[model samples]
Target: MVTRIEWLDAGLELLATEGAPAITIERLTDQLGVTKGSYYHHFGSAGGFKAALMEYFEAQFTTRLIDTIDAENAKPRAKLEHLLRLVLADPDNAALEIAVRAWALQDPDVRATQERVDAARTAYLKELCRGVGADVDPDRYAQLLYLILIGAEQVLPPIGRAELREIYNLTLRLID
Candidate 1:
């Protein structure tokens, strides 16, 4: 039986490859090697699936990551470095982020979810800045960090992971 989490993961994969328009039941069932019956068994309806998918996206990509980082007992600088490494580790994750942001442009639900994610991410960055004892305003530093990331993801071809990692490392040097 395909669990809800598996369905959500398949939805995200389809989303990354084809954006939101390709997330129909037929497509998802095809991708998951399952029947429409399985989808309905897990999600009840399309709207239900969409709602759960957004929540799952936020939880999987944002909140849960933050929680995992917080579980570490490392110093602020170490935590900051760790966060950068984890977020930039996977190229596919960047593709998903870009796809979701693009989806947000045309869908109100996606827009709301994206807004919430951005706000949460920025807030966490600010908190990390404060912890790092940033010389500049925490808000400014946080927004700058996030802006750099969002901009990096949106650029033509996007910044390669190595270059983006180095850019973040340079920013990290400024933290101390």
Candidate 2:
């Protein structure tokens, strides 16, 4: 039997490749090599499945962004750079984020969830900036950095390790 987390991961994979509109109970079950009944056993409906996706995203961002940044070992600058590196390294995440932004245009719930996650990410970035003694408004810097990071995902071609490190370094300087 597929666990809820497994189902959600499959859903996100489908969303990343085929886009949100392609996600349906039948498609999910087919992708999972299960029956519609199995799908329903885990998620009562398409909305439930989508909600699970959103929850997964929230948990992922919280773990990677909030919890990772709050680690006791890293300094403020290191934490901020680590956050950017994490974002740059995850192509799956970048694709899912692009998919989610598109889905948010039509789905209010998705939009709300995306906004909530964005707010949390921004807040964390802001705190990092303050910790580094940037002498700028944290929210403003956060917003600017967030936009740049998202835009970088689009404009810059997919990068390798060295290129990603360069971009992270540039981001740190930009915000600093």
Candidate 3:
């Protein structure tokens, strides 16, 4: 039997590869080699699946990363580095982000989800900046960092992971 996580994972994969428009019940069922009943059993409808998928994205991408970094009990700068490493480790992450950002532009619900994710990530960055005792304003610095990442993901062809990682390193160095 296909589980809820399997459905959500397939939905997320479809979202990342083909944008939100491709995430229909038919596509998910076909992609997962399951029946419509399976999709309905887990999500009730396409809208329900999208909603759950966004929640899953937010939790997996934001809260889980923060929790994982926090669990390290490292110093602030170390945690910051750890965060960067963890983010860069997943190449699919950038693709998913780009797809999601595009989806946000055309969907109100998606935009709201994107906004919350941005706010949460920026808030964490601000906390880390303060903990790192940077001389710059934490809010501005955090926002700047967050903006760079968002901008990077939206640019034509998008920034490659290695280049983006270097860009992050340079930005982080500015406060170091």
TM-scores of all models?
0.96, 0.88, 0.95
Candidate 3: which stretches are off by over 4 Å?
none
Q: 1-176 in candidate 3: lDDT tens per residue? A: 89999998987899889988898888888888888998888888878988999999999999999999889878988998888889889878888998888999999998999999998999998888888887888789888877887788878888888999899988888787
Q: Which candidate leads in TM-score?
A: 1
The models' CA-based lDDT, in order, is: 0.89, 0.78, 0.88
- For model 3, name the residue pairs that clash: none
lDDT tens digits by residue: candidate 1, 1-176: 88889999999999999988999999999888989999988889998898899999999989988998999998777877788888888888988898899989998998999999999999998888888886778788889888988899989978998999889888877767
**lDDT of candidate 3 at residue 63, scale 0 to 100:** 94
User: Candidate 2, 16: how far from true, in Å?
Assistant: 0.4
Better of 2 and 3 by TM-score: 3
Looking at model 1, the pairs that clash are none
| Candidate 1 Cα outliers beyond 4 Å, as residue runs | none
- Every model's Cα RMSD, please? 1.0, 2.2, 1.1
Clashes of 1: 0
